[model samples]
Target: LEIQKKGNEWAVVLDSKYNRRIDANTKMEVSGAAKKEVLKDKKFAYGTFANCANGQTPWGTYISCEENFDDYFGSSDENLKFDENFKRYGFKTKSEYGWEKFDERFDLAKNLDEANRFGWIVEINPFDAKSTPIKKTALGRFKHENAEFIVEKDGLVIVYMGDDEIDEFIYKFVSKHKYVKGGDTSKILDEGTLYVGQFNGNVGDFRGSGKWIALEYGKNGLDESKGFKSQADILINTRLAA
Candidate 1:
């Protein structure tokens, strides 16, 4: 469910019996591991700038991508950093919409290091608004332009995702688990494989088809030689991952 506030506190109309008020400093329980340890206490996870998108999952969750995080994190005077990959892929370290300097947290933006906490396809159980949004790294990363789902003739599930940049690659995640008639959406999303696309051709050759490779685990991982990796890495450094 999409919720927002004009200034100060915003109320979450959870149900006919439960109407809760959440503010910039509202304590909440967000799902994530700090240095890999599971935290159970509820802490504040939202504030004034909670703009999200309009995409729903088959399992029934809302995905919110963190675009322009630099805006809330504050702006940086230090030149944006780029590597060979950036040059090969035609990306600029410099950004026109500078906002990283205003707030250091938005630099990711607050416990906004938690903002990397976001990025992965976030799963929000709109049916249960109090449910913590789960970032599905299994979805890979990039700008996460969009997630499109289509069922195959044989009843398989297929998802198409675009990176939304000049030369960024495309991605597709085929679930290891099939969609069931009455399955839990959160469980289905939490478990799946992620992949990234690799196109081979000369600078001007854009007419041929490309290949989709799994950024799988262990033997089938994404590396410098083959490209791509765990969904977490892909989600955190999506631009570079592509």
Candidate 2:
């Protein structure tokens, strides 16, 4: 979808050539931290279309979020084992969308890894029609509400995001590299430090200082001892790490 301004008015037009409507069946590539060893060659997965909120980058790209994605997958009564991360991310025994009725990928009982593929912040380049959207797993996955970025004076980007569910945490991603004008900002999200907020002080007093806890693997007991194999594992199960 593109918004174009004519001589006197602005109009929203569907540029089918450049505009893409990703559905449940669409396939995408997984990148960032999730591309590590355990998920190396398994970087491809089905689409993510339950976009609730979106954000844009300074380089003019779209960030599509997947919210309430768990409702699209169905469960089974065969006592199938579910990924512990699934329970933390709120996978139900029954699907609201019932997408599993048609596609077996939506059935967690059948494809356990399918559910892990969604709930990510996907980046789409509206300018390039041939470009495939990237699933930025380094930003951490959850019920992503929105992803807003603030570029500092030195060109370092700080991305602020939130988990929409009640009592959920707020997150921020700081790019490891500084942004350069006229340079490629597409891969900036691929490598970054993800942090979760922890508020202190009384509830009614808006005068509390908060801390941004780093979610990096091997830091603060986020290593294999805690069942986190790599940075990708921590990001995929961000809710549990938070």
Candidate 3:
């Protein structure tokens, strides 16, 4: 939807692409991952649900977050084994919305990997109504609350986002490239490192500073031994990696 400011009045109206189905293209280039891992070749998904809160990018695009997405999916067959990853993400034999009963895509028994497709921040272009919504996988996937944009003095960006679950986690994505007005801002969200927030100093105390630990794949024991096969794996299983 677009909110336009007139002389003395503000007009809020539905956009041309309002209530549109999300494009299922996974444009991110994740290499050598299993075809059955998430979406086939980590390449596609159906649609978005539970989009609770949103934010805007410095480049003026809409950031829609998926929250409580696990509620849409469930296992029709309880005999189907669920892994630790599934438990961490809060998938279950039965979901709150029971969408699995109607949509096979929501059934974990049928499409287990489909769960991984959700829970990431989806970016939509306001300028191009026909634009495909890009899932920013560089930002770790979770039950996202909202992304707060922080523009560095030098034009780089730091995106702060919370997991939106009790005692979950907070993360920040720092961009490697700088943002230039009217210049290309593609890499600002695509190429970045994610860091989980670390709180220091406490014990019934109220105020303190917090440190950030990078959730990079090869750093601090996040290797194949721990089941992190690639950067995409780290991004998919962010909570466990953290």
Clashing pairs in 3: none
Predict model 2's lDDT versus the native.
Answer: 0.84
Q: Write the per-residue lDDT of candidate 2 for residues 75-159, one digit (tens) a residue.
A: 6644665667888878876888878777887888877777778888988888877777778898988999999989999999999
| True-structure RMSD, every candidate | 7.5, 2.2, 3.4
Q: TM-score order of candidates, best first? A: 2, 3, 1
Better of 1 and 3 by lDDT: 3
For each candidate in the order shown, give its overall lDDT on alpha carbons: 0.49, 0.84, 0.80
**Residue 196 of model 3, lDDT score:** 96
Q: After superposition, how far is residue 92 of candidate 1 from its true place, in Å?
A: 9.9
TM-score of each: 0.61, 0.91, 0.87
Tens digits of per-residue lDDT, candidate 1, 175-234, equal 666776566444454455557788766566556656777654343445546454433444
Cα lDDT for residue 131, candidate 3: 64
Candidate 2 lDDT trough over 10 residues, lowest sum: 35-44
| Stretches of model 3 off by over 4 angstroms after superposition | 3-37, 41-43, 203-206
